[model samples]
Target: MPIRVKLDDMLHERRLTLSELSARVDITLANLSVLKTGKAKAIRFSTLEAICRELDCKPGDILDYSAED
Candidate 1:
């Protein structure tokens, strides 16, 4: 995928666990795990907003894009 998820890096930088983040965002661990592993097909704006709010980061901090060939 051209879009890469940097969730792990953010979690490490913020010293947060996935379980904690899941709770803060009110998202299921299963769904967050899929996103964390770069396996999610899509993410809703509301969910992203909640994550950003809890993590004190921007969408760019969590997601990055690169040209694929």
Candidate 2:
């Protein structure tokens, strides 16, 4: 996928575990893991907002787009 999720990098930079992020975002581990691994097909704005607010980051910090080769 050209669009990628940078959640792992953000979590690493913030020194946070997926469990911690899940708690803060009120999202389940399975779902968060899906997102973190870039396997999720879509993300709701409210969910993204909650994550960004807890992580103190913008949506760009977690999401990126690259042209497909």
lDDT of each: 0.97, 0.96
lDDT of 2 at 62: 97
Per-residue CA lDDT of model 1 for 1-69, tens digit only, reads 999999999999999999999999999999999999999999999989999999999999999999999
Clashes of each: 0, 0
Give candidate 2's TM-score: 0.97
TM-score of each: 0.97, 0.97
- What lDDT tens digits, residue by residue, belong to model 2 across residues 1-69? 999999999999999999999998899999999999999999999999999999999999999999999
Cα lDDT of model 1 overall? 0.97
The candidate maximizing TM-score is 2
* Best lDDT among the predictions, by candidate number: 1
lDDT comparing candidate 2 with the true structure? 0.96
The residue-level lDDT of candidate 1 at 8 comes to 98
- Which residue pairs in candidate 2 collide? none
